[model samples]
Target: MSFINFNFEPSLQEGLDAMGFDRPTPIQEMAIPVIMQGKDLIACAQTGTGKTAAFVLPILNKISKSGSNKLNTLILAPTRELAIQIDQQIQGFSYFLGVSSVPIYGGGDGIVWEQQKKALETGAEIVVATPGRLIALLAGGKMDLSTLEHLVLDEADRMMDMGFSDDILKIVNYLPQKRQTVLFSATMPPKIRQFSMKFLHNPEEISLSIGKTAEGVTQSMYSVYDGQKEELVRHILSQKAYESVIIFASTKDKVKALYKVLRKEFDIEAFHSDLEQLEREKIMSNFKNKAVKILIGTDIISRGIDVVGIELIINYDTPSDPEDYVHRVGRTARADKEGEAITFVNPKDQHKFVRIESLIGMEITRNPMPEGFERGPEYLGEKAKSSGFSSGGDGKSKNKKKKKPGNKPAGEKRNSESGFKPRADFKNAPPAHKQEAPKQEAKKTEPSDTPKSETPSKYGQRKNVIDS
Candidate 1:
């Protein structure tokens, strides 16, 4: 439906019109009405489903209507990348509305910390912060939240996974119990529901497309050994000149190694958890501007990145958690645009990939290993699925939300008993739609054009990149 139906304040409406946001996404359509009514809510939707705007739009509208304009809303995010991203969306959405926000995340030096502290102590109607640094600010018991009318827990499930449950609860203790609370997660595991119950008062619940990949994502995989993964990455990059690509591995070492190997032939950067905040931001700026064409990082970035026109996502290492596979693939095919995802599955990761397959209820087309490489594994198939692998990643146990039945596309089958299956021939999913890179002159990255890493707003904003 058109955004005009929401009847937002004129200033907010002006911002939406200027930004060219005329229609609402399904998630936004369902959640915005509930939020505008000033009700607490628990929303679960896949990444890139406009989850951020679902709440941000209503919150901005309410702020415009009330005109309090002072520490009215507090949003907690799992990572600095996300905090910055949410703050940016607020910036864009509130441009004409005159709503000011401060992003408080850690990893910044003294100057940044002081700047954030001043903003928190003085003004800014909305504060989007990471749990750790916010907790640090609250430790002095000087930061006040008694005036907070709204509390948002964006990417709620990711916070739980990062062991921020206690920190979040502590922060909640500082907020007004009478405030409206909104919790948004990509998944609704039991723990998240329990967490919600503790604070969100009789919240309105909305869940959509759980455990399903985006419709526009063309999914595929390559079976390879550890020794053969580098060559495979090279071959894939050579085969197609994807303008913007993200390669996800499990560790910083892997990201760095891949960057070293591919730098000369391709304009690429490695994004892990090791770079300083400025270094990270500079890399991200370059990547978004198309100064660098490739980004390599870990699971930390999957949900935080929201750049449009991303043509490919390559999993350099198999993500052990099935849901992670969903997030990684979600990186591409955003904004209802076609894109592709290719996973490199080594023999050791076969069972993990099997869990992924079962979760999505489809078989990904496994391309033959390039001409001369040895075949990776037997792909134990159903046997491996039953061979006692935990659905969570590694030794960590994630409380996976049971797959809810999602609406399948036309010509796709709905498996009522399990999850919805897109089609038996997902193996033959078509290549992503072609879009040439932005024609800007290439800007060279510093440090001899070598090792690195970096998120944004249209359905152009969400994500962070780092090196560890």
Candidate 2:
């Protein structure tokens, strides 16, 4: 049915029409009616399911009916990016309804603080904020929520993951007790169920696609050595079908490094917590507009980003948490469009693969690396060699060196300088910078001990003695 069939205000309908959204998503269709009736709700839906609109629409409807635009709603989100995104969507849907909205989050200039203070002073219709900043403002007496008629915990699971349960409780203390509460999440862990019980009053549960990946996403994995991951990613990008890829790395440092590498080798950008707010916004906007071909990101982008037409998602490294894997791959295949998710799995991360397999309840088909792509492990070895560093047994620096046989001599030693006996290994060990020298000295000192006849060591001979 059309959005008009939901009987939204003409102004809201006009805004929806302008945005080309004619019909409600399944979650919205099922949730909006129940929410408009002022029932508490616990909604389980994947990202890109238009779940935001489900709650926002009914909240706006309630505000319109009450004719109150004075701090009547508070939507708490887990991240600055998500807070801003939800604020933007609220503005979009309520453009003609005169709903004043402000996003209060950290990292923006003091200007956000000023804007937030001013909005609260002048009675904003809705306030969307990250829990920390909003709670701080409320505690500092900069904002009041006593008139709040609705409370929304957007991305509730993420909030719980972010350790915001205490903050949520603190914020809820200021909210009116008889108000509607809505909790939305991509997955429903037991903690989330507990959280709902604590906050919601016999909430109506709405679940769409529970314990499943988005149907539109085509999931696959490439089995390659760690050394080939980067080249394999590049080769995948070279394919005509691969456009606007979001590559997920496991760490912030990797995100920055990968972004730098991709920027040098191809047209790409990176998003992570380390970026300045403006830089992050710029990268997100450019990527959204198709000005950038690739985005190297960490889990920061996994929860809130809603860019459309993302052709593929590349897991540059396997996600440590299976839920993060779900969110990362969910970035693509949005709005009913078919998309692809390719994960790069090296042998070192087999346990992680098993965890993901168990979580998703499906095998990630192993595909061969693209032809001409070099393996990552071998490439790192060659790189180390080229840089005059030896790739030791563990593929790290050889200069670090292993312990010599007689460094401790089976006894501890006393340090006269400190008047205390140190461990024999410590007493005989060279200084940090002299570690390499000991290796050469040990080689020379041990040559005579080498058994030319391949005789066993004393421990091996002792085994025969014991047996006799």
Best by lDDT: 1
TM-score attained by model 1 = 0.82
Q: Per-residue lDDT for 1-468 in model 2, tens only?
A: 888877877766877898899878999999999998889999998788999999998888777667775778889999887887897788777766766777777764555456556656766778888898887798888877777888999999999998999999988888889999999999899999987798789999998876567888889886555555655565566555344789999898888777655553466677776656766777787888877767888899998898989988999888878888889988998899889999886545555666777777787776754433332332231123234323322322221112343434323311232122222221122234533444332121111110122444222211111111
Give the Cα error of residue 95 in candidate 2, in Å.
1.6
Q: Mark the regions of model 1 whose C-alpha exceeds 4 Å error after superposition.
A: 386-468
Writing each residue's lDDT as its tens digit, candidate 1 over 357-447 gives: 8888789988886643455545566676566434322312211122234634433322433232222322122113312344354233221
Worst 10 residues of 1 by lDDT: 459-468
TM-score of every model?
A: 0.82, 0.79
How far is 251's C-alpha from truth in model 1 (Å)? 0.3
